[model samples]
Target: MEAELRDPIAAIGLDVEAVDLSVAGKRRMLRVAVDQDGGVTLDDVADATREVSRVLDESDVMGEQPYTLEVTSRGVDRPLTMPRHWRRNADRLVKITLVEGGEFSGRILTSTETTATLDVEGAEREVAHADVAKALVQIEFNRKRSLPEAEETEEDDA
Candidate 1:
């Protein structure tokens, strides 16, 4: 079902991050998490929800059983499991658990396919993706926002 939904979702410029079907007594819930490089807006969710509903309606995948459909952005609470996830989260604070049995918090400096460089305690640490068991973006209530050099504007010379 997920494989079938990917193309339609991608056509609308959103990645299908997750799809889940859960049952609560007689009712079933279909939850689809969508995301993009920058992030997902409410508009994106609405578009995705409409597209998903259209696809489901056109196909026989859902059958006659009524189910609730929810299309939402992949929340920050989800573990960073892909290279794109790491890249999208660069400069964000993250808590990572290693497969070997240790955990640490750091700001992501950069990421490649095989590894991610993190600024841990003012030092840059490169960690292999294979060594990480889980990684989640940390929520900061008072995060500092700074413009990069190229993005900084200077007063016009009148």
Candidate 2:
């Protein structure tokens, strides 16, 4: 089912974050989560809902069951699992639990395939992906967005 939907979702510049199917009484519920590099907007969700509905209507994958389709962004609660996920969430605050039994909270400064450099407290620290058990983005309601180094340099020049 996911294989069938991947290409179409990718065509519209979104990654298929998750797909869930559940039965509730007579109708089945289908939830699709889509995300992109920047973030998924309301328009993106609407477009994805339309595209997913169109695909399901034309295909036999759902097997004639009445289902409600919901398309949405991969919410902040989703754990950072991939390098791309880490990259996409740069500059955000995150809580990391290590596989070896320790945890820390930091702001993501940069990310690569094997490691992420975080601003832990006031110092920069590099954490290997392999050592991480789970990492979730922390919600900040009143946090200031940090400017990039280049932007800070330009501001200093001015």
Candidate 3:
């Protein structure tokens, strides 16, 4: 049953993050969470849900029992474990926890197949691929300030 839903979804270029099957009363429900490049959209969720439903209907993977299916994206708080996921999110600040028990906060300057470079303390540091215990994207904000009066007045007078 799991393969029934996973195979078709993967074939369509959608990622299946998780799948859950539950029984409530006399009916069963299937929940699937999916994601893809640039994040998952409502349309993507809907399309996957529809496709899975169609496949299940045709294959009767669940037998004669009645069931429901729900498909959605993994939330923003999802852990960054895959290297590709990290590479795709380059240029964003990230909080990385090392295996030895310390944490580092920096911006991801670049990423390669087995390692990533982080701009820490104004210097680039190379972090081994296996040393990262956990990593998450850091939300950033921009601030604008007014120029000093001398500069402002000089520009105005000129």
- The lDDT leader among the candidates is 1
Candidate with the greatest TM-score versus the true structure: 1
State the lDDT of candidate 1 residue by residue for 1-158, as single tens digits: 89889999999999999999999998999999999999999999999999999999999999999999999999999999999899989999999999999999999999999999999999999999999999999999998798665566542322
Query: What is model 2's C-alpha RMSD?
Result: 3.5
TM-score of each: 0.90, 0.88, 0.68
**Candidate 2: what lDDT?**
0.94
Model 1 is weakest, by summed lDDT over 10 consecutive residues, at 149-158
State the displacement of the C-alpha of residue 81, model 2, in Å, after optimal TM-score superposition. 0.8
Q: Candidate 3 at 43: error in angstroms? A: 2.2
Which segments of model 3 are wrong by more than 4 Å? 1-3, 22-29, 59-67, 140-158
Root-mean-square deviation of every model: 2.6, 3.5, 6.4
Give me the runs in candidate 2 sitting further than 4 Å from their true place. Answer: 146-158
Candidate 1, lDDT over the whole model: 0.95
Sort order, lDDT high to low: 1, 2, 3
- TM-score-based ranking, best first? 1, 2, 3
